[model samples]
Target: MRKRNVFYSLFFFLHLLQQASSDVHSISGYFLGSQGLNLPDYMERITVDDVGMYYYDSTMNAEVPCPEWLNTTEGQEHWKDINLISLDNRHRFASSLQSAILQFNLTGSSSNVNVYQGVGRCSLYPDGTLKAVLTHAFNGEDFLSFDIDTKTFIASVPQAVIYKRQREENPVFLEHLTFFYKKTCFERLKILLQHAPAVNMKKVPEVRLFKRTKAGSKVLTCHVTGFYPRDVQVEWVGAGLQSVEEEMVDVLPNGDGTYQTRRSVIRPEENPEEHKYSCVVHHSSVAGNVTKTWEEHSGLAAWIWISLICFFLAIAGTGLLFRRLCKTKDVGI
Candidate 1:
């Protein structure tokens, strides 16, 4: 039920992981805010495939769509309606925050503001099926949730039980949620996807393997960049077909039309060659998994550097001999 920063981060990470492991598209809406003017009074955001569709906050007081997210006529109308809805919700948000404060006895002066947030999201599977979830949080902790599949409310904390029971008793809000997520949300996303420019395509990501040594510690980093559709996997595979993973950051857009991400793993200090670790990537755009092997010590690269140095020295010697032949003794130092 709780979702603001940590919730969104973890949820989106799992969302992208699912995208890589399966075939599905999702749309999500977020409403987050504090109780008063000490912070953002009310904020709303929507996203598709991890790309922001629009942003709304007390500062902006408008649902400002990202550059191309509202280009289509239908999208413009949809935002206009959504903006009105958000405006009404912004007013309701104050009361909701106050209720949360009262629920937890968190009331205080204007300087000591409390926070509340909620989210609703739906994911469309490859077979055209959709699932929706709703969650609410207070002071950065989950309290209540709704499962669209079960059509029931769940209380994550004792304070949330009353609200859950109220929602379960009242059929109106539940019915509205069903319609909005199943019909309105899906239709809007489908329209937007259909209207995207023809140039948008699933692009194979460019992958690179590199290492960084710091404080006598070395680590191998797999950099995967410039990919499309927000679905890609980067992992470190070690000996005996074991998949070793550290903290792989979330996929982020490159401001172009593609996305980039990185994964890093510790480089073994002892007998590193015994592992033969490799960075492996998987994406729909790629025919198969892309594997890049890494080594702690690269003799081939050292030999290549040595060969280049020798070639350059030989060229310098030839130049020096030519200068002597031309009787030019004063070679510039």
Candidate 2:
């Protein structure tokens, strides 16, 4: 099933932003609450520069930090305050999930699940300028957003009218939210960056090429995997090639806490010797761009077959996780 999967989309978006500006730093927190699934009832996670920094669950009922994340902050008030906030957010997740289901009129059927994602994030750039965003989405599409520049709520979809109007009436609440996103979140991001060590620094990408024939049409893919700091750029180009139409799959996760992404393009009519095509990648992890050309050897068909099978299996293992990238907020009455 091809779920919209806001979690994947948001991560992809963050990756794009990071890839765009190598010097930009950001911190994001995600809270998920659900029922009738093969997962925990509620969970919270924090990411610093696309790496997991902290995690919490209702069952464990405690915030666990990555050793690298706390290596410089042990026995300090910073960790203590963040820990308390995580505990308090456990209760908020329950109410927010319930409110979301009711607000969206989710049927809660066995076969259907919709992701209602709300994001509150702040990014600090090399120029000492910061950008803040506060928005919510339903099924990877925008529903509502708070414009930091205007300090007003925007209902992007019809379903979000209720929340937009309700929040608009409460100017005090909006003021406090603006303060959190603009000031507090950035402060948190700077503190975490200051304490974070070189252990979790940028991860260089591993790239490969795979050729597959489906329905008598040839497709070439550049598979890049096992990378950190999720910003990456992939393009198809070679001698005498202007541009080749390619499709980029979502930035999927690896169990070892790294990430992978792929770009595939249908082969155009051309001779391998005369019209060679290569995949070029650009990212901060690498000093410069990395390029890999496709090789079509006589005995390569058998190897490509095996690679195609593994590709499908990998997608099967990675479930279509349709969820949100929301910031920690007081969702209380």
**What TM-score quantifies how close candidate 2 is to the native fold?**
0.68
Flag regions of model 1 displaced more than 4 Å.
1-22, 35-39, 62-76, 147-153, 161-174, 197-204, 212-219, 235-278, 287-333
Clashes of each: 1, 1
Highest lDDT against the true fold, candidate? 1
Regions of model 2 farther than 4 Å from truth? 1-20, 65-75, 103-116, 138-144, 147-176, 198-200, 214-217, 237-246, 249-252, 265-277, 297-333
Tens-place lDDT digits, model 1, residues 251-302:
8767665788988776767777556778889987888988888765563465
- Model 1, position 4, has a per-residue lDDT of 53
TM-score per candidate, in order?
A: 0.68, 0.68
Count: clashes, candidate 1: 1
Question: How many clashes does the backbone of model 2 have?
Answer: 1
